[model samples]
Target: MEQKKRKSSATIASIETEYVRSLQKKASRKHARKIRLYRRLTVFAVVAAIILVGMTQMYMKQKQVLEAKELEKMEKTAQLEEVQQEQEALNRQLIKLDDDDYIAKLARKDYFLSENNEIIFSIPENKKKTDKKDNGKE
Candidate 1:
């Protein structure tokens, strides 16, 4: 009888030790899982930040390029308008040159030409007033 009682007590002690060991293992596994989860979250946050910064830089660069193109477009438009105005003035001069009367006047004034049996007279310009002003300034 005493032998049976001792055997039962020893068995209960072994079972209690096993239960305590299992509990310790469970706590350790939970702690390790928490650490792993924290590490994963940290890595995810870092990667997200890097991606955000990269996208922002790309957007800013593209915006700058677009602004430069817009400025170039404005400059080209202004130059085209100026060229068109110059072309209009040249067209007007071309029209004037096509007239016979204008051509005759231009030839007489610039080349000292005259028609047959026509008389031409020459007169000096009034340069004395301009000369006096220039002499005083100089």
Candidate 2:
């Protein structure tokens, strides 16, 4: 069986004394103070979280920039080394070109030029290839 409860249509009166009023005011003030304290703490926590995130983002950006700079520096250093090596090779070639004997030998080989009393013999490319092969076999 289910029972239905009826509401009482009656009004209750509270004691209206100075001591009761003072106690109620004190209780309300304490509740208000607690609310204010909680609000302040929430604001502080939010600000601190924002500051921490900002610092972390800044640190990550700086780290990425530093890594990129180091990579660029390494690439530039490699390029500089290659350029230095090429310069050294050119310097050696220049020194060799300054020698008269080397220049004469280069000219004779490339231009088929001969010195006085020296007969220039023109060998066929096919004969030279065959000679190289025979030498290798030996």
Candidate 3:
């Protein structure tokens, strides 16, 4: 009975040692897998940070370029308005030229003409001293 008890005790001790060794190996494997996953996640996070910075820089540059284009467009619009005002002024002058009284007065001052065959009278009191260049003939 003593030898049987000793043999059984040895067998139980061996089984316990084997089970503890197995559990240690499985835990080490799980810890190694966790370390590998942590490395992959760290690499992914770094890549995402770099990409985010690059995209933000690109957005700022594009926004500046668009703002410059908008300013240029506004300048061009102001120039167009000035040209339009000049064109309207010329149109008004053209309308004045089309008036019969204005044209007839211009013709009488530019060319000697009379409604009837009347003699030309030069009144010294009505005549003011002027040069030929001042009259725009030179």
For 1-138, candidate 2 gives per-residue lDDT tens digits of: 122222222344568999999999999999999999999999999999999999999999999999999999999999999999999999999999999999999989889999999888889999999999999999
| Candidate 3 weakest ten by summed lDDT | 124-133
Worst 10 residues of 2 by lDDT: 1-10
**Stretches of candidate 1 exceeding 4 Å from the true structure:** 1-20, 117-138
lDDT of 1 by residue, 1-138 (tens): 999998998888444688899998999999999999999999999999999999999999999999999999999999999999999999998999999999999999888899999888765456777878899998
Of the candidates numbered 1 and 3, which has the greater lDDT value? 1
What TM-score does prediction 3 earn? 0.59
lDDT of 3 at 126: 35
The residue-by-residue lDDT of candidate 3 on 77-127, one tens digit each, is 999999999999999989999999988777666664545675655545334
Tell me the lDDT of candidate 3. 0.85
TM-score per model over all chains = 0.62, 0.63, 0.59
lDDT on C-alpha atoms for all candidate structures: 0.93, 0.93, 0.85
Better of 1 and 3 by TM-score: 1
Which predicted model would earn the best TM-score?
A: 2
Candidate 2: Cα lDDT at 123: 90
